[model samples]
Target: MSTITVDLNSKVVPAAQKIWIVHPGRNRSHIDTFESAGVVFLEFPALALRPEIIADDSLLRQRIRYSTAVKANKGFVRDDGTPIHIADYPTAADTDVSVHLRTVKHLTTRMMAGDLVIVPGRGAGGAVLFGEVAGSFFPQKSIRAAGLPFADTPVREVNWLTKRSKLELPAHLVKFFEKPPAIAEVGRDRWSEGFFDFAYDAYSTDARSWVSLDAPQYDGSDILSLVPPAELLALAVSLYRAMEQRADLTGLDYDQIIARFYDHDALAEAQMRFQSPGRYNLKDKDAKLAKWINGFVALALAGALSACSNGDHIEFTNKQAPNDPANAELTAMINMAGQSAGGAVLTKAETQAQHAQSKLGMSAPATVR
Candidate 1:
């Protein structure tokens, strides 16, 4: 049986004082009021803006005008009073641009850093959405409605915590839902602690929880320190070579080899890097490129191990294992080194040396070394 290790230090600790719960929509009468007055509330699904457009005042004004027209069902008009139909502005979608812009402006200008906005869960026992305002308000194209008309929206850069997992309120914190406020601040008291504890517990118990992986677990920190790419590549290559040469390791299962090598940390770290949105600049561009390179190294090593497998057993024969060629995904990851991202690759000599060192029970040298 494989033993699972939990890193207590890596668990996410929620801050209650920064938390605020928001009701997604107003009463039906209120929505009707806005609609009757030719005002679009644009509260459904929530509006997320692009960064580039937010910075440009002139561009933002134009987008707002178009967006407002779309929301109001009034055709857009050029500054020179020429009517621009919705078909003419294929970039604008059904988003309420005015509300999105105003909301983004309010969030960026009025909200403090580290503030968290919580969107209530739909239906009974459903999960709520938690969005942490990571940065100031900015205008950018919407990923949710990309390549469609009216795609531009105002968005505050947010680190959404509950994007993947749904969280239920703990039994103790259920009272807050009794009279859920349209927008209420969650204090750093017992209720807040209970809520986070419930969230953490829910996250831990989920089948898709990241905590089960052995890599440096995500603690919602902006800065993440990771192993260097070159060093990681060397380790992966060395592991591949070791698996290739070991006669005693034949017929062992993949899990057995993984346990023996005890390098899941590297594997997990790599998986996180490769999978993380920040690595692809989907979130923050400067989230640390080192992590991405480290991910590539992890992928290479994991691929090398995977390539040696024949069905349920690991084939350690030299004929079967030359490089990690069997894994197309791994090959693609290694090829990333040649791409614009510029990750490191291990030389044959260096790989051999590292393999020899591993055979002698020596740890791989640090990146700096």
Candidate 2:
């Protein structure tokens, strides 16, 4: 929910394109092939997941579940006593693995021309390289190794879009470089008009200011806008709860514990558990995913509170958020808003969103009036 400073007033809006973060390797072993061949590729799990099985999501998931899981009976037998094919193991139950599976599937089937790609610094170095997926996915059989784990694997052709290295990466996108997936979509919420415009045509940011939370609009801020209505409601509930917890704490207690909790959920038990990050719904068990989501939720709730407060303050408004949060995770969000906004606390904002409340199985606050 933290507002960005992308060129919000551009006369022409760029088409919303799918953005992907791809890591060439742990040590960037495939950087050469990725650039020279003008392509990006995914690492295959098993030799059995060929074009046929990999093409089907259901089959892939089932195959992964079997393949990654331990089989008590040994040597791959099915629940129905039929011999399970080694190649067709179900996709693993792990979210990252599932996402990785989708990456493989997406590059082959979902990725299309003009879709954007961000090759990590490890592959491109100090600056990230932005490219456009330009051609079809290559699933040619590679005899060099089984399951295509080498430099030459399944690939999708790309055309480098930006000629100059983007040294000053947008802050929101820096996290991806630190802990990237072999393949994962950049959540629509995180898309930046500044980055997109720059990647596309070298749009300048000389005239814009860092959009404050209280700004009347943040149109190109895809993260908040693209969030599903139901999830947004859930996020709202989490924010109100966080506000309450911060309210009761005094001075150091508020600063050290309450504020710190929501501000850095990754350091604690990250309460927000969404999947595929920015786009999908909750998945509590994914530790890495939880860490990312809670941290993001903290920022979002903080930003929202800050925004809803009076304009011109550009900092926490002078009111303390009245309602308490479920834990420190929520408090950090509230404190971040309050501390930054000159100590302005957010009023409790519960909901009449019966559908969302019913689905989430939690009480919501009334609107902050």
Cα lDDT of all candidates, in order?
0.35, 0.43
lDDT of 1 by residue, 252-340 (tens): 43334334543333322232332322121111112212222223233233333222121122221112122322233323333332221
How well does candidate 1 match the true structure, expressed as C-alpha RMSD? 18.1
Number of the top candidate by lDDT? 2
Error of 2 at 6 (Å): 27
lDDT of 2 by residue, 183-217 (tens): 77775542443445335321112222111011112
Residue 312, candidate 1: C-alpha displacement in angstroms: 37
Query: What ranges in model 1 sit over 4 Å off?
Result: 1-7, 10-17, 22-69, 74-106, 141-151, 163-167, 170-187, 201-369
Q: What lDDT score goes with residue 333 in model 2?
A: 48
Q: Give residue 68's error in model 1 in angstroms.
A: 4.7
Scored by TM-score, the top model is 2
